[model samples]
Target: MKEKLVVFSGAGMSAESGINTFRDSNGLWEKYDIYEIATPEAWNKNPELVTDFYNQRRKNILNVKVNQAHLEIAKMENLFEVTVITQNIDNLHERAGSSNVVHLHGNITLAKSSGPNPEKKYYPIKSWRLTKNDLCEDGYRLRPHVVWFGETVPMLMEAQNIIEQADYFLVIGTSLQVYPAAGLVHHAIKAKKKLILDPKVSEMQVPNDFLKIEMTATSGIIEALDLMR
Candidate 1:
Protein backbone atom coordinates (compact mmCIF):
# COMPACT_ATOMS: atom_id res chain seq x y z
CA MET A 1 0.00 0.00 0.00
CA LYS A 2 1.18 3.54 -0.68
CA GLU A 3 2.00 5.77 2.23
CA LYS A 4 -0.39 8.60 2.90
CA LEU A 5 1.09 12.08 2.33
CA VAL A 6 -0.92 15.09 3.34
CA VAL A 7 0.23 18.44 1.93
CA PHE A 8 -0.88 21.69 3.49
CA SER A 9 -0.16 24.36 0.91
CA GLY A 10 -0.68 28.12 0.86
CA ALA A 11 -0.23 31.29 -1.26
CA GLY A 12 3.53 31.18 -1.25
CA MET A 13 3.34 27.88 -3.12
CA SER A 14 1.23 29.53 -5.80
CA ALA A 15 2.95 32.95 -5.78
CA GLU A 16 5.81 31.67 -7.94
CA SER A 17 3.24 31.00 -10.65
CA GLY A 18 2.68 34.78 -11.11
CA ILE A 19 -0.19 34.86 -8.65
CA ASN A 20 -0.04 37.28 -5.74
CA THR A 21 0.29 35.96 -2.23
CA PHE A 22 -1.81 37.28 0.59
CA ARG A 23 -0.79 40.79 1.75
CA ASP A 24 1.30 41.69 -1.28
CA SER A 25 3.84 44.46 -0.89
CA ASN A 26 1.09 46.79 -2.08
CA GLY A 27 -0.77 45.66 1.07
CA LEU A 28 -4.05 45.88 -0.79
CA TRP A 29 -6.31 43.74 -2.95
CA GLU A 30 -7.07 46.13 -5.79
CA LYS A 31 -7.05 49.40 -3.77
CA TYR A 32 -9.38 47.98 -1.13
CA ASP A 33 -8.44 47.61 2.50
CA ILE A 34 -7.95 44.01 3.63
CA TYR A 35 -10.49 44.53 6.37
CA GLU A 36 -12.94 46.02 3.90
CA ILE A 37 -12.69 43.11 1.51
CA ALA A 38 -11.70 39.95 3.44
CA THR A 39 -13.63 40.14 6.67
CA PRO A 40 -17.16 39.06 7.50
CA GLU A 41 -18.02 42.55 8.69
CA ALA A 42 -17.06 43.94 5.31
CA TRP A 43 -19.20 41.36 3.53
CA ASN A 44 -22.16 42.30 5.70
CA LYS A 45 -21.59 46.07 5.46
CA ASN A 46 -20.76 46.24 1.73
CA PRO A 47 -21.74 43.25 -0.31
CA GLU A 48 -20.88 44.88 -3.66
CA LEU A 49 -17.31 45.60 -2.67
CA VAL A 50 -16.89 42.03 -1.47
CA THR A 51 -18.33 40.59 -4.66
CA ASP A 52 -16.26 42.93 -6.84
CA PHE A 53 -13.07 41.98 -5.01
CA TYR A 54 -13.67 38.30 -5.73
CA ASN A 55 -14.74 39.06 -9.27
CA GLN A 56 -11.32 40.54 -9.92
CA ARG A 57 -9.72 37.56 -8.19
CA ARG A 58 -11.52 35.17 -10.49
CA LYS A 59 -10.18 37.07 -13.47
CA ASN A 60 -6.64 36.82 -12.18
CA ILE A 61 -6.91 33.08 -11.78
CA LEU A 62 -7.81 32.80 -15.44
CA ASN A 63 -4.49 34.34 -16.46
CA VAL A 64 -2.05 32.13 -14.56
CA LYS A 65 -0.97 28.51 -15.08
CA VAL A 66 0.19 26.07 -12.46
CA ASN A 67 3.92 26.25 -11.86
CA GLN A 68 6.37 23.35 -11.59
CA ALA A 69 5.87 23.13 -7.83
CA HIS A 70 2.16 22.39 -8.16
CA LEU A 71 2.83 19.98 -11.00
CA GLU A 72 5.47 18.07 -9.04
CA ILE A 73 3.16 17.63 -6.08
CA ALA A 74 0.49 16.28 -8.38
CA LYS A 75 3.01 13.92 -9.94
CA MET A 76 3.90 12.62 -6.51
CA GLU A 77 0.22 11.94 -5.87
CA ASN A 78 0.35 8.89 -8.12
CA LEU A 79 3.00 7.34 -5.90
CA PHE A 80 1.25 8.17 -2.68
CA GLU A 81 -2.17 8.98 -1.41
CA VAL A 82 -1.68 12.74 -1.66
CA THR A 83 -4.27 14.81 0.07
CA VAL A 84 -3.77 18.57 -0.33
CA ILE A 85 -5.20 20.91 2.25
CA THR A 86 -4.71 24.41 0.92
CA GLN A 87 -5.30 27.84 2.35
CA ASN A 88 -4.95 29.31 -1.11
CA ILE A 89 -8.17 30.24 -2.90
CA ASP A 90 -6.69 29.60 -6.35
CA ASN A 91 -7.28 26.53 -8.55
CA LEU A 92 -3.63 25.93 -9.41
CA HIS A 93 -3.64 22.56 -7.71
CA GLU A 94 -6.61 21.36 -9.70
CA ARG A 95 -5.08 22.73 -12.87
CA ALA A 96 -1.91 20.80 -12.10
CA GLY A 97 -3.96 17.59 -12.00
CA SER A 98 -4.02 17.14 -8.27
CA SER A 99 -7.05 14.96 -7.61
CA ASN A 100 -7.56 15.50 -3.88
CA VAL A 101 -7.67 18.96 -2.33
CA VAL A 102 -9.46 20.64 0.54
CA HIS A 103 -9.71 24.40 0.42
CA LEU A 104 -9.74 25.55 4.04
CA HIS A 105 -10.32 29.27 3.45
CA GLY A 106 -12.68 28.58 0.52
CA ASN A 107 -12.23 28.94 -3.22
CA ILE A 108 -11.98 32.15 -5.29
CA THR A 109 -13.26 30.29 -8.33
CA LEU A 110 -16.48 29.35 -6.47
CA ALA A 111 -19.53 31.54 -5.68
CA LYS A 112 -21.88 31.23 -2.69
CA SER A 113 -25.23 32.63 -1.68
CA SER A 114 -25.34 35.29 1.02
CA GLY A 115 -28.76 34.47 2.37
CA PRO A 116 -29.88 35.88 5.72
CA ASN A 117 -30.12 32.37 7.12
CA PRO A 118 -26.76 30.67 7.65
CA GLU A 119 -28.31 27.36 6.68
CA LYS A 120 -28.86 28.65 3.16
CA LYS A 121 -26.09 26.85 1.28
CA TYR A 122 -23.60 28.18 -1.29
CA TYR A 123 -23.35 26.55 -4.67
CA PRO A 124 -20.51 26.57 -7.18
CA ILE A 125 -20.96 28.75 -10.28
CA LYS A 126 -19.71 27.46 -13.62
CA SER A 127 -20.17 30.89 -15.20
CA TRP A 128 -17.22 33.28 -15.18
CA ARG A 129 -19.12 36.17 -13.66
CA LEU A 130 -21.48 36.11 -10.68
CA THR A 131 -23.34 39.36 -11.17
CA LYS A 132 -26.07 41.18 -9.24
CA ASN A 133 -28.66 39.28 -11.22
CA ASP A 134 -27.16 36.04 -9.93
CA LEU A 135 -29.25 35.20 -6.92
CA CYS A 136 -30.15 31.95 -5.17
CA GLU A 137 -33.72 30.74 -5.39
CA ASP A 138 -34.28 32.68 -2.15
CA GLY A 139 -33.11 36.02 -3.60
CA TYR A 140 -30.03 36.41 -1.35
CA ARG A 141 -26.92 38.09 -2.72
CA LEU A 142 -24.36 35.76 -4.27
CA ARG A 143 -20.89 36.15 -2.82
CA PRO A 144 -17.51 34.49 -3.20
CA HIS A 145 -17.33 31.14 -1.44
CA VAL A 146 -14.22 32.27 0.42
CA VAL A 147 -14.19 31.69 4.16
CA TRP A 148 -13.44 35.20 5.35
CA PHE A 149 -12.23 36.12 8.81
CA GLY A 150 -14.88 35.73 11.56
CA GLU A 151 -16.45 32.90 9.54
CA THR A 152 -15.63 29.44 10.83
CA VAL A 153 -13.25 27.33 8.77
CA PRO A 154 -15.81 24.71 7.89
CA MET A 155 -13.22 21.98 7.21
CA LEU A 156 -10.91 22.35 10.19
CA MET A 157 -12.15 19.17 11.82
CA GLU A 158 -11.77 17.09 8.67
CA ALA A 159 -8.30 18.54 8.07
CA GLN A 160 -7.23 17.56 11.57
CA ASN A 161 -8.23 14.00 10.84
CA ILE A 162 -6.15 13.98 7.65
CA ILE A 163 -3.16 15.38 9.48
CA GLU A 164 -3.42 12.81 12.25
CA GLN A 165 -3.43 9.75 10.00
CA ALA A 166 -0.72 10.92 7.63
CA ASP A 167 2.53 8.99 7.45
CA TYR A 168 4.09 12.15 6.05
CA PHE A 169 2.93 15.75 6.46
CA LEU A 170 4.19 18.57 4.25
CA VAL A 171 3.44 22.27 4.44
CA ILE A 172 4.41 24.43 1.50
CA GLY A 173 4.85 28.20 1.10
CA THR A 174 2.76 29.25 4.08
CA SER A 175 4.04 31.18 7.09
CA LEU A 176 1.72 29.15 9.30
CA GLN A 177 0.87 32.46 11.00
CA VAL A 178 -2.86 32.17 10.48
CA TYR A 179 -4.72 30.55 13.31
CA PRO A 180 -6.52 27.21 13.12
CA ALA A 181 -4.56 26.32 10.02
CA ALA A 182 -1.33 27.32 11.69
CA GLY A 183 -2.31 25.24 14.67
CA LEU A 184 -2.61 22.12 12.49
CA VAL A 185 1.02 21.14 13.04
CA HIS A 186 0.07 20.12 16.54
CA HIS A 187 -2.20 17.42 15.18
CA ALA A 188 0.71 15.43 13.78
CA ILE A 189 1.92 13.07 16.47
CA LYS A 190 5.53 13.10 17.61
CA ALA A 191 6.47 10.10 15.46
CA LYS A 192 5.08 11.42 12.19
CA LYS A 193 7.57 13.43 10.18
CA LYS A 194 6.56 17.00 9.23
CA LEU A 195 8.27 19.04 6.54
CA ILE A 196 7.72 22.70 5.75
CA LEU A 197 8.99 23.91 2.39
CA ASP A 198 9.37 27.66 1.97
CA PRO A 199 12.15 30.04 1.01
CA LYS A 200 11.33 32.70 3.56
CA VAL A 201 10.72 30.58 6.65
CA SER A 202 10.60 32.65 9.79
CA GLU A 203 10.42 31.29 13.32
CA MET A 204 8.09 28.27 13.36
CA GLN A 205 7.73 26.87 16.86
CA VAL A 206 7.29 23.17 16.28
CA PRO A 207 7.94 20.45 18.86
CA ASN A 208 11.24 19.50 17.18
CA ASP A 209 9.27 16.90 15.26
CA PHE A 210 8.96 19.08 12.17
CA LEU A 211 11.69 19.93 9.65
CA LYS A 212 11.86 23.15 7.66
CA ILE A 213 13.18 23.10 4.11
CA GLU A 214 14.30 26.64 3.43
CA MET A 215 13.70 26.41 -0.30
CA THR A 216 10.86 27.18 -2.65
CA ALA A 217 8.20 24.51 -2.99
CA THR A 218 9.16 23.52 -6.54
CA SER A 219 12.75 22.75 -5.65
CA GLY A 220 12.01 21.77 -2.08
CA ILE A 221 9.37 19.16 -2.80
CA ILE A 222 11.73 17.62 -5.38
CA GLU A 223 14.46 17.41 -2.78
CA ALA A 224 11.95 15.96 -0.36
CA LEU A 225 10.90 13.29 -2.84
CA ASP A 226 14.51 12.35 -3.48
CA LEU A 227 15.16 12.00 0.23
CA MET A 228 12.09 9.83 0.68
CA ARG A 229 13.30 7.64 -2.17
Candidate 2:
Protein backbone atom coordinates (compact mmCIF):
# COMPACT_ATOMS: atom_id res chain seq x y z
CA MET A 1 0.00 0.00 0.00
CA LYS A 2 1.10 3.54 -0.68
CA GLU A 3 2.12 5.56 2.32
CA LYS A 4 -0.47 7.97 3.67
CA LEU A 5 0.42 11.64 3.15
CA VAL A 6 -1.70 14.24 4.90
CA VAL A 7 -1.35 17.85 3.78
CA PHE A 8 -2.37 20.43 6.34
CA SER A 9 -3.00 23.54 4.29
CA GLY A 10 -4.05 27.03 5.25
CA ALA A 11 -5.16 30.33 3.67
CA GLY A 12 -1.65 31.01 2.46
CA MET A 13 -1.83 27.87 0.36
CA SER A 14 -4.88 29.23 -1.47
CA ALA A 15 -3.40 32.75 -1.58
CA GLU A 16 -1.03 31.51 -4.24
CA SER A 17 -4.13 30.74 -6.30
CA GLY A 18 -5.36 34.36 -5.89
CA ILE A 19 -7.61 33.55 -2.98
CA ASN A 20 -6.93 36.12 -0.26
CA THR A 21 -5.92 35.11 3.21
CA PHE A 22 -8.11 36.26 6.09
CA ARG A 23 -5.41 37.93 8.19
CA ASP A 24 -2.75 38.94 5.73
CA SER A 25 -1.70 42.56 5.30
CA ASN A 26 -4.45 43.46 2.79
CA GLY A 27 -6.50 40.37 3.47
CA LEU A 28 -10.27 40.19 3.76
CA TRP A 29 -10.01 40.46 7.52
CA GLU A 30 -8.42 43.89 7.13
CA LYS A 31 -11.24 45.18 4.93
CA TYR A 32 -13.94 43.75 7.20
CA ASP A 33 -14.17 43.00 10.86
CA ILE A 34 -14.39 39.30 11.70
CA TYR A 35 -17.09 39.91 14.26
CA GLU A 36 -19.06 41.86 11.67
CA ILE A 37 -18.97 39.38 8.82
CA ALA A 38 -17.48 36.10 10.02
CA THR A 39 -19.24 35.01 13.13
CA PRO A 40 -22.49 33.36 14.21
CA GLU A 41 -23.39 36.53 16.04
CA ALA A 42 -22.79 38.54 12.89
CA TRP A 43 -24.99 36.19 10.88
CA ASN A 44 -27.73 36.63 13.43
CA LYS A 45 -27.26 40.38 13.76
CA ASN A 46 -27.33 41.10 10.02
CA PRO A 47 -28.02 38.15 7.81
CA GLU A 48 -28.00 40.37 4.75
CA LEU A 49 -24.47 41.52 5.43
CA VAL A 50 -23.34 37.95 5.96
CA THR A 51 -24.97 36.84 2.72
CA ASP A 52 -23.44 39.73 0.78
CA PHE A 53 -19.99 39.00 2.18
CA TYR A 54 -20.06 35.34 1.14
CA ASN A 55 -21.59 36.21 -2.22
CA GLN A 56 -18.64 38.42 -2.98
CA ARG A 57 -16.25 35.72 -1.78
CA ARG A 58 -17.97 33.18 -4.00
CA LYS A 59 -17.75 35.57 -6.93
CA ASN A 60 -14.06 36.14 -6.30
CA ILE A 61 -13.28 32.41 -6.22
CA LEU A 62 -15.29 31.73 -9.36
CA ASN A 63 -12.72 33.70 -11.33
CA VAL A 64 -9.67 32.41 -9.48
CA LYS A 65 -7.68 29.49 -10.85
CA VAL A 66 -5.84 26.81 -8.93
CA ASN A 67 -2.11 27.55 -8.72
CA GLN A 68 1.02 25.44 -9.17
CA ALA A 69 1.15 24.58 -5.49
CA HIS A 70 -2.26 22.91 -5.66
CA LEU A 71 -1.29 21.05 -8.84
CA GLU A 72 1.95 19.77 -7.39
CA ILE A 73 0.21 18.63 -4.25
CA ALA A 74 -2.36 16.75 -6.31
CA LYS A 75 0.45 14.99 -8.16
CA MET A 76 1.52 13.44 -4.87
CA GLU A 77 -1.20 10.83 -5.39
CA ASN A 78 1.29 8.91 -7.54
CA LEU A 79 3.51 8.31 -4.53
CA PHE A 80 1.19 8.41 -1.55
CA GLU A 81 -2.40 8.28 -0.42
CA VAL A 82 -2.76 12.04 -0.48
CA THR A 83 -5.41 13.76 1.57
CA VAL A 84 -5.56 17.56 1.66
CA ILE A 85 -6.97 19.07 4.82
CA THR A 86 -7.56 22.72 4.02
CA GLN A 87 -8.73 25.70 6.02
CA ASN A 88 -9.96 27.47 2.92
CA ILE A 89 -13.59 27.66 1.86
CA ASP A 90 -12.68 27.70 -1.84
CA ASN A 91 -12.83 24.76 -4.25
CA LEU A 92 -9.37 25.20 -5.72
CA HIS A 93 -8.16 21.87 -4.33
CA GLU A 94 -11.05 19.98 -5.89
CA ARG A 95 -10.48 21.75 -9.19
CA ALA A 96 -6.83 20.72 -9.09
CA GLY A 97 -7.73 17.00 -9.25
CA SER A 98 -7.11 16.14 -5.64
CA SER A 99 -9.16 13.02 -4.89
CA ASN A 100 -9.42 13.20 -1.11
CA VAL A 101 -9.88 16.55 0.58
CA VAL A 102 -11.10 17.41 4.06
CA HIS A 103 -12.40 20.94 4.29
CA LEU A 104 -11.87 22.18 7.82
CA HIS A 105 -13.85 25.29 7.06
CA GLY A 106 -17.19 25.11 5.29
CA ASN A 107 -17.51 25.44 1.52
CA ILE A 108 -18.47 28.81 0.06
CA THR A 109 -20.25 27.36 -2.99
CA LEU A 110 -22.82 25.66 -0.77
CA ALA A 111 -25.56 27.01 1.46
CA LYS A 112 -27.22 25.68 4.58
CA SER A 113 -30.55 26.64 6.11
CA SER A 114 -30.77 29.19 8.89
CA GLY A 115 -33.78 27.42 10.37
CA PRO A 116 -33.95 25.53 13.63
CA ASN A 117 -31.61 22.98 12.08
CA PRO A 118 -28.79 24.91 10.47
CA GLU A 119 -26.34 22.05 10.02
CA LYS A 120 -28.61 19.26 8.90
CA LYS A 121 -28.57 19.89 5.17
CA TYR A 122 -26.72 21.93 2.57
CA TYR A 123 -27.82 23.23 -0.82
CA PRO A 124 -25.57 23.95 -3.77
CA ILE A 125 -25.83 27.30 -5.54
CA LYS A 126 -25.03 27.52 -9.25
CA SER A 127 -24.35 31.22 -9.24
CA TRP A 128 -22.02 33.19 -7.00
CA ARG A 129 -24.91 35.25 -5.76
CA LEU A 130 -26.75 33.78 -2.80
CA THR A 131 -29.40 36.37 -2.12
CA LYS A 132 -30.96 37.02 1.28
CA ASN A 133 -34.35 35.82 0.09
CA ASP A 134 -33.02 32.48 -1.09
CA LEU A 135 -34.57 29.84 1.10
CA CYS A 136 -33.88 26.19 1.65
CA GLU A 137 -36.47 23.44 1.15
CA ASP A 138 -37.37 23.91 4.79
CA GLY A 139 -38.63 27.45 4.12
CA TYR A 140 -35.74 28.98 6.08
CA ARG A 141 -33.40 31.52 4.52
CA LEU A 142 -30.13 30.17 3.19
CA ARG A 143 -26.79 31.01 4.76
CA PRO A 144 -23.27 30.46 3.55
CA HIS A 145 -22.02 26.99 4.46
CA VAL A 146 -18.81 28.48 5.90
CA VAL A 147 -17.62 27.64 9.39
CA TRP A 148 -17.62 31.11 10.85
CA PHE A 149 -15.85 32.14 14.03
CA GLY A 150 -17.40 30.81 17.26
CA GLU A 151 -18.64 27.76 15.35
CA THR A 152 -17.24 24.24 15.65
CA VAL A 153 -15.25 22.74 12.81
CA PRO A 154 -17.33 19.69 11.93
CA MET A 155 -14.44 17.93 10.17
CA LEU A 156 -11.88 18.31 12.92
CA MET A 157 -12.21 14.72 14.08
CA GLU A 158 -11.88 13.36 10.58
CA ALA A 159 -8.84 15.51 10.01
CA GLN A 160 -7.22 14.29 13.22
CA ASN A 161 -7.80 10.70 12.22
CA ILE A 162 -6.19 11.32 8.84
CA ILE A 163 -3.27 13.13 10.43
CA GLU A 164 -2.71 10.34 12.90
CA GLN A 165 -2.54 7.85 10.08
CA ALA A 166 -0.04 9.88 8.04
CA ASP A 167 3.33 8.46 7.20
CA TYR A 168 4.31 11.89 5.92
CA PHE A 169 2.74 15.10 7.22
CA LEU A 170 3.11 18.25 5.13
CA VAL A 171 2.14 21.71 6.26
CA ILE A 172 2.01 24.38 3.59
CA GLY A 173 1.56 28.16 3.79
CA THR A 174 -0.08 28.08 7.22
CA SER A 175 1.05 30.30 10.04
CA LEU A 176 -0.21 27.68 12.47
CA GLN A 177 -1.83 30.44 14.50
CA VAL A 178 -5.48 29.50 14.55
CA TYR A 179 -6.85 27.13 17.11
CA PRO A 180 -8.29 23.65 16.71
CA ALA A 181 -6.90 23.75 13.19
CA ALA A 182 -3.58 24.94 14.58
CA GLY A 183 -3.66 22.15 17.08
CA LEU A 184 -3.79 19.51 14.34
CA VAL A 185 -0.02 19.35 13.97
CA HIS A 186 0.09 17.48 17.24
CA HIS A 187 -2.03 14.72 15.79
CA ALA A 188 0.75 13.97 13.31
CA ILE A 189 3.18 13.09 16.09
CA LYS A 190 3.33 9.51 14.89
CA ALA A 191 4.29 10.42 11.35
CA LYS A 192 7.71 9.25 10.24
CA LYS A 193 8.40 12.55 8.49
CA LYS A 194 7.07 16.11 8.82
CA LEU A 195 7.64 18.96 6.40
CA ILE A 196 6.65 22.60 6.75
CA LEU A 197 6.76 25.20 3.98
CA ASP A 198 6.29 28.86 4.73
CA PRO A 199 8.35 31.97 4.07
CA LYS A 200 8.03 33.61 7.44
CA VAL A 201 7.67 30.74 9.86
CA SER A 202 8.09 32.13 13.32
CA GLU A 203 8.28 30.59 16.77
CA MET A 204 5.68 27.91 16.29
CA GLN A 205 6.31 24.65 18.08
CA VAL A 206 6.76 21.45 16.14
CA PRO A 207 8.60 18.14 16.18
CA ASN A 208 12.37 18.66 16.20
CA ASP A 209 12.66 16.49 13.11
CA PHE A 210 10.45 18.65 10.89
CA LEU A 211 11.96 19.87 7.63
CA LYS A 212 11.26 23.58 7.34
CA ILE A 213 11.36 25.23 3.94
CA GLU A 214 11.19 28.99 3.73
CA MET A 215 9.41 29.90 0.52
CA THR A 216 6.06 30.64 -1.10
CA ALA A 217 3.64 27.80 -1.71
CA THR A 218 4.45 27.27 -5.38
CA SER A 219 8.17 27.47 -4.86
CA GLY A 220 8.09 25.47 -1.67
CA ILE A 221 5.94 22.75 -3.15
CA ILE A 222 8.25 22.49 -6.14
CA GLU A 223 11.17 21.86 -3.84
CA ALA A 224 9.09 19.48 -1.72
CA LEU A 225 8.14 17.43 -4.77
CA ASP A 226 11.81 17.24 -5.69
CA LEU A 227 12.70 16.02 -2.23
CA MET A 228 9.96 13.43 -2.36
CA ARG A 229 11.36 12.19 -5.68
- Top-TM-score structure, candidate number: 2
Q: Write the residue-wise lDDT of candidate 1 on 1-229 in tens digits.
A: 9888888898888887887776547434556678988997998798888788788788888788899989988998778888999999998999999999999988877777787653357677775577888877777777888888778888999999988898888888887778888998788763256777878765555547667788877777788665544
Candidate No. with top lDDT:
2
| TM, every model | 0.91, 0.95
TM-score of structure candidate 1: 0.91
Q: Provide the lDDT at 127 for model 1.
A: 59
The CA lDDT of each predicted structure is 0.80, 0.87
Looking at model 1, the pairs that clash are none
Q: Residue-wise lDDT of candidate 2 within 13-119, one digit each (tens)?
A: 98877888877798877788899999989988999888888889899999999999999889889989999999989989899999998889888999998878888
